[model samples]
Target: MKILVAAAAGMSTSLMVRKMEEYMTANGLVGVVDAVSVAEAKERIRECDVVLVAPQVRFELAGLHQIAEPLRIPVGGIPAPIFAGMKGEEAVRLAQDLIAQAAEPTS
Candidate 1:
């Protein structure tokens, strides 16, 4: 699966991508990840399994979800600390959990 991290400038998310890559590598998670500016995110969203937006851009959450929902892909914002700290593995785990939850049948 592919994950896309987006932010206003895409600079911070780039660092987050590195952390996530490390976590994925260390944990043997077979997935691809990338970072992009919101403009680029529009084009990249179609290709991703999940879309994580930086907390700094929470204002864009609704619009992003609208686009991603039709694709049946999940979208949400990562906390500031997680993004700033670049905890890549945690991000991957988070995405994995979300996917699992989505696949489950609710009561």
Candidate 2:
């Protein structure tokens, strides 16, 4: 799975990506996680299975959904508490859940 994390300046999300990368390594998950600015995120949404926006920029979720929905990719805002705490595993679990949900047929 590929996950794209977006933030205001695409700066803060790097830490989250690092933590997620560590989690992926530890769990042997072949997933890739990366961070980008909202503009850049728009360009790469198709290359990702899930899109997570930083809490500080959660307001963008609606716009993000507009992009992800048509692509059938899941998009959501990371929970502030967990994101602020830098809970990598928890974030990974959230991404997994999004990917799982996206895989399900929604009639």
TM-score of every prediction relative to native: 0.87, 0.94
Which residue pairs collide in model 2, if any? none
Alpha-carbon shift of residue 8 in model 1 (angstroms): 1.6
* Best-matching candidate per lDDT: 2
What is candidate 1's lDDT per residue for 1-107, written digit by digit as tens?
Answer: 78888788656777788888888888788888887777788788889888888888878889888888777778878877777777776778788876666567669
Candidate 2 — what's its lDDT?
0.89
The 10 consecutive residues of candidate 2 with the worst lDDT sum are: 7-16
Return the TM-score for candidate 2, rounded to 2 decimals: 0.94
| Candidate 1 segments exceeding 4 Å error | 105-107
Local error of candidate 2 at residue 96 (angstroms) = 0.6
Whole-model lDDT values for every prediction? 0.80, 0.89
Per-residue error for 4 in candidate 1, Å, reads: 0.4
lDDT tens digits, residues 2-103, model 2? Answer: 999888764457888999999999999998988888888888999999999999888888999999998899998899988988898999999999989989
lDDT of 1: 0.80
lDDT of 1 at 37: 78
